[model samples]
Target: MRFLLAIICCKLLRLALRLLGRGGTALPGQVALRICPDMLSRLSRGVRVAVVTGTNGKTTTCRMLEKMLRDAGEDCFANRSGSNLERGITADFVSNADIFGRPRRRLAVIECDEAAFRRVCGELAPAVCVVTNVFRDQLDRYGEVTHTLGAIREGLDRAAHATVCLNADCSLTASLAADAPDRVRFFGVDAPLGGAAAVSDAPRCIFCGAQYEYDYHTFAHLGGFRCPKCGYSRTEPDVAVVSVGALTSEGSAAEVRIDGELFDVAVGLPGGYNLYNAAAALSAATALGVERRSAVRSLAHMESGFGRMERFEIGGTRITMVLVKNPAGCDRAIDYLRSLSGECTAVFCLNDNAADGTDVSWIWDAGFERLFDAGGAELRLIVSGERADDMRLRLKYAGADEGDIRVLRSQDELLEAVTSAGGEVCILPTYTAMLPLRAALAARCGRKEFWK
Candidate 1:
């Protein structure tokens, strides 16, 4: 009776919120959970589930995994709005089910928050679990990088039977396989990427306090990492990108060797980070028994999601929005902006909302200096959001000219500046700031809301 009531109430609340022009993905689930404490566990009883959680790339990994399942004639539902907490995931599961609390789709791909990973994973008992990578993120909320890793480890401790897909290149993520050695499937890049690496979130070994040695770095702290004192090293990935032939502003082309066979793969998303995401998705798909050929085919045409390198055109301007929450992610987004061809305007939006970590100090750790140094003809900078002044000051310290940096206070002013900008526009926004900017862009372009 409790389960039935929770589902009915959740559905009704979701309907009402949609009618009222709001995205109520999490609130309804929160209310439902209050009514039925075990509502998520109960509803997810008979379903085949794969939960993806980590510091970044959860949504993009879920997107590619969902496409793999759907393309192979399987019906699946996912939390597509980036509402990855316990409440939002519960809401998604409830809304996809019938009134009697039975899922219409037998399969699900869930993107989960790292902080909520332990509780949600224990409830779902997923058949497969994927951890993309971990970095220093939301220090105000999650404490430290080790705490985030411990949360994932605790979650995996509950689902002992699940197959784990991990990034072999990430020392933090690869360390999860220590306990469940036999059940882990590793994925990473095998070839060396040419360029300087970003500031590593994990410079010292988690197991041994000694500094890690890297044979080659793909980006950030991810690469062929080995702890000097403990002798902990990267395991050979079961799914590996043997070489990267082309990585442009449009997409990435690479050769992936999976299960002893090499296949050429193309990912529609841009950036070296996305190469890891593709490998993670493919590893999860294979763990779930999807054909490797079919899964690899889906990678060639995967579409970018909202605020993850999503592109739009309005009023003779092209806008690309990439969500950045932490130093590692911000640095990657800035690197992507540096890869653009013609003259472009770069907009950095920072918000101190509860969703985006209240502490705005992480901006100073990002590689804004590199972006400023790589400036080209007509390259401009615009700072907007609730903390636009803070971002402007940070850019100034990174060698950006105060005269060249324009600060726009409101969303309307930012939109107007974007529409009137004379070149391609690239936007870097924290989580909360991306929401309003996405809505305003959708309204102007007559596109559907991302959650729907």
Candidate 2:
């Protein structure tokens, strides 16, 4: 009776929120879980599930895997609303189930928050789990990167039956494979990207306290890393990018080796970090028994999910918005911005809300210095959101002229600034700030609301 009530209430609340023009991704599931605390476990039974959990690429990885499954004629649902917590995931499952708590679709792709993974993983008992690289993120909430890693490891402990897909390039992520050795599959880039290295989140070995030596670094702490003391090293990946081809502002093409067979894959997303996402998604798809060739073909047509390299156009201005949460992601966004040619305006929107992490100190660690150093196109600067002043100050410290930075505090001011800006525009916003700013951009451009 409680299960039935939970399902009915969740559906009704979702409908109510939709009618009220709200996303209704998390609250309905929260209410449903209150009515039945074990609702997720009960509802997830008899379903084939793949859960993607980590700091950076969870949502994109889930999106890619979900698309691969759908392209192969398997009906699957995911928490596409960017609500990755327990409540939001529960809401999605309930919405896809009937009043009797039976799933309409047997297959599901879920993106789980790292902190929530420990609590949600056992309940979902996913057939396949992918852990995209771990980096320092939400320090106020998760404390440290190691703590975030511990949370994911605990989640894996609960998911004994899962076929784990790990990033062989990330030392912190590769460490988790020890928990489920026989069932583990690895993916990574075989060649170095030859970019300037930023401060590494995992500078020393997780197993031993000794500093790590790199054969070459892709960016941040990822790439071929070897611990001199304990002799720990990167494992040979089952799926790897053997060579990188053309990388344009639109997308990237690479030669990938999947299970010893080479296939030229063109990813529909920009940035080298997305190559890791593609490899992770392909690893998860293969684990789920999806055809390798069909999954590889799906990467060429992947639509951007939410704020990850999402593009919009307003009044002759081409705008690209990338969500920046931590140093690693911020550095990658900066790399993408550097890749662009011609004149462009760069906007950094930051908020110190609870959801955005109260500590804005991570901005200091991000490579804002590289943006102003040299190279790239002619760039203009705009800072907005609740912490607009802080962003401006950070850019100043990164060697920007104080007069060149425009501080726009309100949404109206930001929208006006963006629309009036000349040439291409790139906006990087923290989590809480991205919501309203993206909404305003969508409204101005006639794009669909995020919920749709």
Return model 1's CA RMSD, one decimal.
1.3
- Show model 1 residue runs off by greater than 4 Å: 194-196, 374-378
In model 1, residue pairs whose N, Cα or C atoms come closer than 3 Å (at least 3 residues apart or on different chains), thus clashing, are none
Q: Please, what are the lDDT tens digits per residue for candidate 2 over residues 1-452? A: 89899888999999999999998678899999999999999999999999999889888999899999999999999989888999999999998898899899999999999999989998999899899989999788998999999999999999989999999999999999988899999999998765557536898989988999998888789999999999999999999998999888888899999999899999999888899999999999988988999999999998886789998888788889999998889999999988888789999999999999999999999988888867777789999988899999999999999999988887888888898886799999999999988888888878898776
lDDT by residue (tens digit), candidate 1, 1-452? 88888999999999999999888788899999999999999989889999999988999999999999999888999988778999999999997899998889999999999989999999999999999999899789999888999999999998877999999999999999998999999999987764447536888888888999988998788899998899999999999998998888788999998878899999888887788899999999988889999999998888788889998888789989999999888878877877787689999999999989999999988878887664443578899999999999999999888999999998889988987885699999998899888888877889899766
**Every model's TM-score:** 0.97, 0.98
- lDDT: which candidate is best? 2
